[model samples]
Each structure stands twice: as structure tokens, then as C-alpha cells.
Target: MKYSSKNAQETEKLGKKLVSKLRGGETIALTGDLGSGKTVFAKGVAKALGIRKKITSPTFVLWRLYQIPKPGRIKYLCHIDLYRLTQSQDILALGINEYWQRKDTVCLIEWAEKIKRFLPRKNLFLVKFEISDLNTRKIIIDGVSDVRS
Candidate 1:
């Protein structure tokens, strides 16, 4: 657990304080690189799952679900982007393990080490961005221990 984000609106306010301690079938794997904010931390976890539209970077439409408006424990947020999918059979022909084994869903996988063997090491969560200069941003978050400020 680490964080730095001196920009992109403090990495979307640390992705809305890490989605208020998410409560859903989480996945969140996101590594970093190109532009390094990862859709501004997925538009702060799609504005804390209320998702007011406009949260781009499915990187040419690889994924993008975002629903969340019911009696919620998070209805959906998918948002995957494996940097244009070279193949892992195109991430299993785009099912993505049925949005990371949906249980009201909350996926969020940017490059995700390019589908690191199709994730799922049991609940999984790995953030890792590191630019640390042009508007800083170090963020680590492996198991996440309240991700200090």
C-alpha cells in the first residue's frame, strides 16, 4: 500500500478513496504506462460507482460495462482495457471470465500485465503505477492496507 498521485486530480482523489473500501466481487488489476493514470484511476472508480457517464479508455472498445444504479453492493463497473489485446485468445474471446466471475461485478483491469495468465489468484487486487515525476504518481496497492495518504 502506497500512494502519491500529485495530479490527475490526485489520481481521481485516490480513486475516490479506493472506492470507499469496495464491497463487491472485486478484481482491479491495473498496471501502468501509457499516460499512467489508467483512465484517471478509472474515473475514480466510476465516480464511486455512481457512474455519471464519460469514463473512456476502453482502448478501442475492449471493455466497458458501468451500470450501478440499483439497490447496490455495486451493480457493475467492468472497465477492462488490455491495451488492444494481442491474444490470450483475445482474452477468451472477450468474455473475460464473464466479467471476473460476476457477483454484482467491479472489475477495472487496465493493461493488467496484459492479461496476466487471466488473473484470478482468488479475489486479486494489484494497482502499481509509478511515474513519479511529470506530475508524480507512485501508487502501489498490492493487498492494500488502507492505502495511506
Candidate 2:
């Protein structure tokens, strides 16, 4: 599916709406340029998961885990940033595989093209972002079809 966002807010809403159909154990692979709306979309996902603190790109720390407050199907949200890493082996060295595909967790990876082949295909949602213009983003989604408007 292809989605166009006029601004960051629209991109974020699209992310929130998409997650509404996700039960758990899903991996979202986000790919795009530095100023793309990847992190903005993630913020929407976090909000939908009931996390209100705030989420930022984990470019330095590598990854950040957000604990969902609940008795829900998803207990944790693993936000991974692969911007600093160049290969899948680096991801393995950090033991990122342990976090993905967990029954009680949802994994969202930024710069995911770096490790796309290593992710579980059956449950991975590939989201590619293309910056159309200032404040406008074109997003292409593959793998899932339940995203609502």
C-alpha cells in the first residue's frame, strides 16, 4: 500500500492507524533518509500502545525498549535504530534477534534495510519512505493489508 503524508502529523496518524490492527509479535522495518518521517510515525505507534513518556531516535544507544503499560497482548515495544550499524552481524552481536518476534512484543526497526534479510519474513512489514518535498512524505508499505484510514 502507498500512503502520502502532507506533514508529520499525517504520517504519525497513518502509523497509529496501522498499529490498530496489529495484535503482537510483529516486526516493522522502516527505511528512508535522515529527515524522513520514520521516527514521527513511531511516535504515533507508541501513543497507540499507551506509552506517553515520549520516544526519540535511538541513534546513539542503538535501541530503546518501551514497556507498554498493560494486560494487553503486547507487553513491550522494541524500538531499534540501525543507523550506526552497517551489517546484520552487528545486530546479532547486540543480540537484537532476542527482542524481535517475541510473542509479547512489537519490534520497530529504523534503517531496517541494513538487516532486512535477517528479519522473519512471515511477520515483517516493510515500510519505505520517500521524501516528496519539504514536510511531505511518500510512504510505501508492504506485507500487511489491514491498515485502515
Candidate 3:
């Protein structure tokens, strides 16, 4: 699906809507240029997951983990930024493979284009964002699975 956002708030709202449909073990690969509001979308997802902590870009830290409590259970959101890494082995050494191997946690990755070769062929969501203007963005979401009701 494609969504157009007039501003950061609108982009985040779209992210929240998408987050509501998310389940454990989902991996989202977010690709976009710098300043394209990728972290804004991630904040929306974090909010929908019942996380109250401040959400910040993990570009410098490489990754950040958050815990969401819902219905007496806890779920994990693993946010990763691969913009600084020059090799896939750097990711592997960080135990990123473990995140992909599990079906109980949700992983959100930024700069995903750098590691597209390592992602799974199925059950993954890829979101691409393009800056159309200073306050506008075009977001495309693909490879999302239909949730069974």
C-alpha cells in the first residue's frame, strides 16, 4: 500500500495504523534517505505497542531494545540501524541472526537496503519512503502478510 503524508504527524499516524496490525516475530525493513522520518514511523509503532519510553534513533548505538507490556505479557521490539556498518559480518557479530531466527520478537531495521541480501524471502514487511517536499513524503509498504481473523 502507498501512503502520502503532508507532515511528520501524518507519517506517524500512518505508522500507528500499521503497528496496530503487527504481531510478534514480524520484521520490518525500512528504507529511505536521511531525514525521511523513518524514526518518526518507528515511534508510532512503539506507541501502539504500549511503550512509553522516549523513542530515539539508534544510529549511533546501532540498536536499541524496548519492552512492551500488554495483557500481562511482555513483547520485545528490536530497533536496529545499519547505516554505519560496512560489512554484513558486523551485523552477524552483533547477534542479529538470533533476532531473525526467533518468532517471538518484532524487529525493525533502518538502512535495510544495506542488508537486503540477508533478509528472509517471506513474512517480512518492506517500507520505502521518498521525500516529496519539505513537509511531504511518499511511503510505500510492501510484502505485508494478511492477518487471519
lDDT of each: 0.81, 0.88, 0.80
- Superposed Cα deviation of residue 98, candidate 2 (Å): 2.9
lDDT of 1 by residue, 1-149 (tens): 78787889988877777777778888888898988897898898788778888988877779978787653877888898889888756887786677675777889889889878878886677898989789998988786577434
TM-score of each: 0.32, 0.95, 0.90
Q: In terms of TM-score, how similar is model 3 to the real structure? A: 0.90
lDDT of 3 at 135: 93
Clash tally for model 3 = 0
What is the C-alpha lDDT profile of model 2 across 59-146, one tens digit per residue? Answer: 8889999999863999899999999997677887876667779988999999998886787877788899999999889999888784
The ten-residue window of minimal lDDT in model 3 covers 140-149
Candidate 1 accuracy as lDDT: 0.81
How close to the true structure is residue 13 of candidate 2, measured as C-alpha lDDT?
Answer: 90
